[model samples]
Target chain A: MYNLIMKDVKLGVPFIFFLFPVLMGALMLIPGWIYFIVLLYFCWITVPNLFNQFKAQNDLMFTSMMPVTKRNMVKARVLVIVGLELLHILIAAIFGVFTMLLYPNLTYLFFPPNIGFWGLGMMMFAIFNIIFIPIFYKTAYKFGWALFFSVMAAMLFAGIAQWVGIQHPVVNDIFYGTGAEQVALQAIILVTGIVIFAAFSIIAYRLAFRRFLRVEV
Target chain B: MLALDVRNVSKSFPNFQLRNVSFQLEQGYIMGFIGANGAGKTTTIKSILNMTRLDSGEVHILGKSMAAHEIELKQEIGYAMGGVDFYTRSKMKTLTDVVKRFYANWDDKTYRNYMRAFKLDENKKIAELSTGMKVKYNLAIALSHGAKLLILDEPTSGLDPVARDELLDIFQGLVADGEISILFSTHITSDLEKCADFITFIANGQIIRSGEKEEFKESYLLLNGAENQLNQVKDRLISYKINSFGFTGLIQADDFDPSCGIKAATPSLEEIMVYFAKKEDQYV
Candidate 1:
């Protein structure tokens, strides 16, 4: 399983993908910017290209030939996706901390890149995974429709979460404020996001495996 | 012991279906899987490997159920399709590094030997290799994993005749130890004629015959006679073609009557396939 994950990283993903997190993370340095887009770049750019690379490379056929089960193949792929999503969020969060330090008194017009925002980013990726993985495995070789639907779902989650963080006073205060209690609430949200991410990814793996079994490849 | 057994396996797609495809390869022999294109050769191979979910029936590899022990059995089974078409941009060395990790018995020394024997340069990307080299590269990896059964699909389709013959020789050498068994699918029956000990012919998603190579050919007789005698044996022929010289057709040996005085000759593998295809065409 570890080897499959590594194979995905080394062969399936291009070198540009590694730089995407860092490149997109730097956008978080723009003080008070819409923070979700930093992570959304993953959905917008990294994912489509990655899955396209898999298709172009005939990855399904190549991987299926190995001494790996279809189930583990899906598991390893989900791990790669989760691993990349985490990297993007973690890097963006680091830059977010720098943004906070650089503009301590800047008036924020959006959800600040606090722990809660990163939590929201994790949630967005969770939704993407739950939708994308299973759908992609339907053909296991085509990704266009899967990418379209998954990115839409992720965008919707991000949009609603950001909207509530802006309009709802309690949610806004928890996300945008810098007080100790607010930070504590943000931490709770972050933990919840982690749980949801893990749970959704697991469910995605199961569903993808079942769908892949029906695929003729 | 049988190295591979595919029994009553079936799968259906919108356009094609494999109907109870059954074949078996004994240990340490090359079994040629011959068919016209779209004859379910690839589908049958995929079913045996469990790459495609079987609609019914089961595949056994080395005396164990394939569905129940896929990963474990796959470790002993090496499957390659045509050539190294995937990861074409990746260098052969990088591809090998990734592939070798999946097998516990992967021998780096053996891999290096095959690479050298095949004249494959590790630094070169897969796309840089020609078709024959691409197939040789795939074989290098398949052979290095200590695989007991090698299932290759159309491994020689694009190769020049000399290269194909070279590949057949390598296949013969692989099975010389009485351990490795190979079941390779190809329409190029001449390659199999040189190396395959057993033959399984598929047409229209069905196994028409499976047996020793000589017996497979010997079961059918190619009869040619004057146009005047055509009606006397028309029903007995599997399919027949007429020309200025007369009529030539394939018929089961049991159906041939020696008293008819028609000339009967042993048909080559290619002739058998052509006659089977003609039979299919005539029915259609």
Candidate 2:
């Protein structure tokens, strides 16, 4: 499995790709940008670019020839996706810290850069994983529809969560209120979101394995 | 134990079907899989490697079920599917590094020796290599890991005579120790003629004939005559073709008719495959 992970690593992506999230993270530095859009940047750029690398090289054929199981291939692929997702998020979080430092009291139209916000990002990614992986694994070749549905789903989560933050008095107050009260609410959402993330990701892995077996590569 | 035993293997596509194809390669010999394009040659090879799912059948490699032991079986089998290159955009070093890690028996000395002998540049991207160079590079990788069985699909199709001969020599060398076995599918009959110990011919997804190479060589007779002589031997001929000047046909050596204006010559593997590929009786 480690070898399988290294296989994707050696098929190095273009340098321009690694820069995508950092550039998106820079958007948060703006005085009053909606942070929800910044979260969308991770899936929008990362998934499409990763799939392109796969299609261009015909990666499944290469991996199938090796002494690895189809199950392990899915495991390694999920790891790579999650690894990149975390990398992009970390870069954005660093920029989020800077944005907060620069404008400590800015009015946030979207959720502020708080622990719960990242927690929400994890849930959106989980939604993307559950939808994208099984559908894409069906053929393991065509990805347009998988990307389409997953993006819509992830964006919907971000959009709905933003609306709740803006309009619901109780939810808005809990998120925007002073440090300790907000921290307590945020901690709850974070734990809940992490739970959803882990659960959905496991479901995606099993679904992907079953669908991938039927793929005729 | 036989190196390979494909029993009653079958697969189906919407428009075609591979029905009950079977053959075996004993522990230390070569089996030449011959067929025309779309003749299920590639499909059979894919099934053996479990690259394609088989609807019904069993493939045993070195006495283990290929379906049940694909991952473990692969460690000892070196497979190269023709025309499909691996990680073509990556450098040779990058691709092989990933491949080498999977085989516990991979020897750096053997890999370097092959690299030097083939004059392969480690940093060169796979896509940049010519067809012959790509085949050589693939062979180097397959041979470096102490693979017990080499399954190559059409490794000789698009090479100059010299390069093809070179590859055949390498295969012959590998099996000389009576430890390694080979199953190479090819449309190029001459390569098989040079090194194959056994032969299996497939047509329209069915195995038409498979046996020892010596038996295969002596079983069929190539008959030659003028165009008008086709009728006299039509019933006896397995397949026949009529050109402007002459008619050529393949018939079992025992079925030949001396009075049909047909003269018999030994049939080559290419002659046999050509006869089998055409669907209708008068296949011209």
Candidate 3:
């Protein structure tokens, strides 16, 4: 499984894919653009583009000839997706911190570079994974439909989180209120997001495996 | 013991279906699967490798069921697809290094030797190589892994005649060890004529005939009759093509009599394949 993941990471992707993330991570410097980084991260490590590389060289058929099982192939692929997503998040988070340090007194318009926003990011990715994986696994090569459904899911998660925070004063206070109350809410949301990320990704993995069993290469 | 066994296998798609396809290859022999363009040869190969899901039936490789022992069986079998599709954008040496990690017994020496023998440059990107070179590179990888059962689909399609003969000789040498077995599917009957011990012919997604090469040929006799004489024995001929000059085809040996002005000659593998591929219901 490690080999499979490395094959796609090292050989499947080009050199540019590695360097492009640094540029996206830099977006955190722009106060208003900070919110855009979350969506930009998805663009940087797009699942559809990753699949385009695979389809371009017929990599699935080539790798399927190796001594790996179909189940493990799906698992390794999901692991690669998760690994890339985490890499993007880690880099973006670092830059986000740097921006916070660089502008300690600046007024923020959107969700501040706070723990709660990161928690929201986690939930957004969880939704993306849950939607993208099992649907893409149904027909390993078709990227358009997977992109449509998964992006819709990520958008839905982000829109709802943002809207609910504004519509109700109490719900808004937990996430936006000062000091201890915000910290506690951030911790709770973060914990829940972590749990969902782990649980939803696992469910995605098993479901993708089952769907891929019916896939013909 | 049989190296590969496919029994009662069936698979269906919107436009194609392979029905009750069955054949077996022994421990040490080259079984050439001959078929026309859309004759389900690749599908059968995919089934044996479990690359495609089957609607019904079973494939056993090395005496273990493919369903229960796919990973283990895959380790023993080396499959080269109908067309070679490696990471063409990457250098061969780098890609080979990555692929080497998948198998426990990949031999660097054997791989290097094959690369040298096939005249494949390690530094060249796969896309830079010609189609023939791609096939050779694919074969080098398959053979380098110490695979006991080699399954190649149209491995010789892109090679020149000289290169095709060289690969055929290599397959013959591999089977001489009495341990390694090879099952390759190809439309090039001449390749099998030189090295294949067994031939299985498929037409329209059905197994037309299969057996030892000699026995497969023995079932049909090549018939050559003049255009005028063709009509006399036309009903007896299994399949015939009447060109402007003369007519020739295949007929079951038992159905032909020398006294009927029908000349019978021993058929080559190509002759047998051609007759079967062109067989029509009206002639039957």
Candidate 4:
């Protein structure tokens, strides 16, 4: 299962690189703060799409023929998704740092004047990962249109959250507010997000593993 | 004792259904799973592997219910799918290593021998290998695990003649130990004719017939004669097809008389398959 996850991550490297320029280019038009939305979109889109393609190519058939169980297959896929999320976060953070150094005076568009933007980014990623991983896994198991709809739904929910965060002043302040107090709050939000993501991921893994166990190749 | 027994297995999808399919493969025997495309050969294999849930039936492998002893059962079995998909960017060695980690009984010496036999370079990426080579690699992985039962679904589907021959040889060598049982599914009957100890015919998602190779061959005779001659033997005919030259029909050798100017020739596995597939159509 670890090998399967690693193989998927390796296969996804080129795709991650392909997205880098587009992501960096988008930063020129949108504020750095809004880049979190792009990062979330990247995670939601790539993870499931890769797995769907893997299935279409009949990878599951070969894998199933191995001694591995359906439970292991689901676990491997979930681990790959988490790995991809981490890859995306790492790359995006690097880009964020680069963007800041290159354009130091440029207003951190996504982060409020005083907030810890990195922490907010982590929180947003955690929330999206929590919701999207299970949705995609269930949809992928059902396959075909179900998989497509689930991904679209995940993206739509993430979009709405980003929209609400950017539009509402009170909500914006809670996430983007600056200073020592807000910094501490951002840290709390980041930790809470990690905890919730971990809990949800476990639930998703169980749901997906059980559902997929019943699935016929 | 039977190495594998599938009892009254049934499974259905919206577009297809497999009903009450049952067959047994004895120890040290090769059972050819003969079926045409979409004939549920893969489905049946899936059920045996517990990869799919049977609507109602039980499968026993090595004297244990598949549901109760899946992992234990699978560990003793090796498999090669019809379409062997791999992570394209992964090297052959990487795949071997990954699969090796899962099986405690993995034999690296046997695996390396197969790799050399098939001329597959461990350094090559999976995507770089040809279809036949990929199949060979899949077989190598399957054989390396010290499997007691090798279940192959069209293992020779896309192979060239040489590769197919080499695979047949490997199978023969593997079963030479007389401890490994093979359940191989293939539309190409020639391969099975050479290596299979028994043959199972599946059509329209059901098993029509299964028995020892010699017995299966002995039961049917291929008769070719003029229309008039065929008419005289028509009562014994299981099925027949007419061509402009005359008529050809399948009959029991015992029932076919040589005096009718009809020659009774041994039916090849392909000929038998056509006969049964046609029989299936007639029932529909």
Against the true structure, whose DockQ is highest? Answer: 3
DockQ values per model: 0.80, 0.75, 0.81, 0.46
Q: Give the root-mean-square deviation of each candidate in angstroms.
A: 1.5, 2.0, 2.3, 3.9
- Please give, for residues A157-208, the per-residue lDDT of candidate 4 as tens digits: 5566567667988767676565577668777766765666566677768877
Query: lDDT per prediction?
Result: 0.90, 0.85, 0.82, 0.73
For candidate 1, what is the total of clashing residue pairs?
Answer: 0
Which sequence of candidate numbers ranks them by TM-score, best first?
1, 2, 3, 4
Q: Candidate 4: which stretches are off by over 4 Å?
A: A1-4, A7-33, A90-109, A113-131, A138-172, B229-236, B252-263
The best-first sequence of candidates by lDDT reads 1, 2, 3, 4
lDDT for model 3, on a 0 to 1 scale?
Answer: 0.82
DockQ of 1: 0.80
Which residue pairs of candidate 2 clash? Answer: none
lDDT of 1 by residue, A1-217 (tens): 9999889978999999999999999999998889888988999899888988998899988998888877788889989999999999888989999998999899888888789888888889999999988999999878888989999999888889888988999888898888899999999999999999999999999999988878878
iRMSD (Å), candidate 3: 1.0
- Per-prediction TM-score, chain A only? 0.97, 0.94, 0.92, 0.73
TM-score of each: 0.97, 0.95, 0.93, 0.84
Best by lDDT: 1
Off by over 4 Å in 2: A12-19, B259-261, B280-284
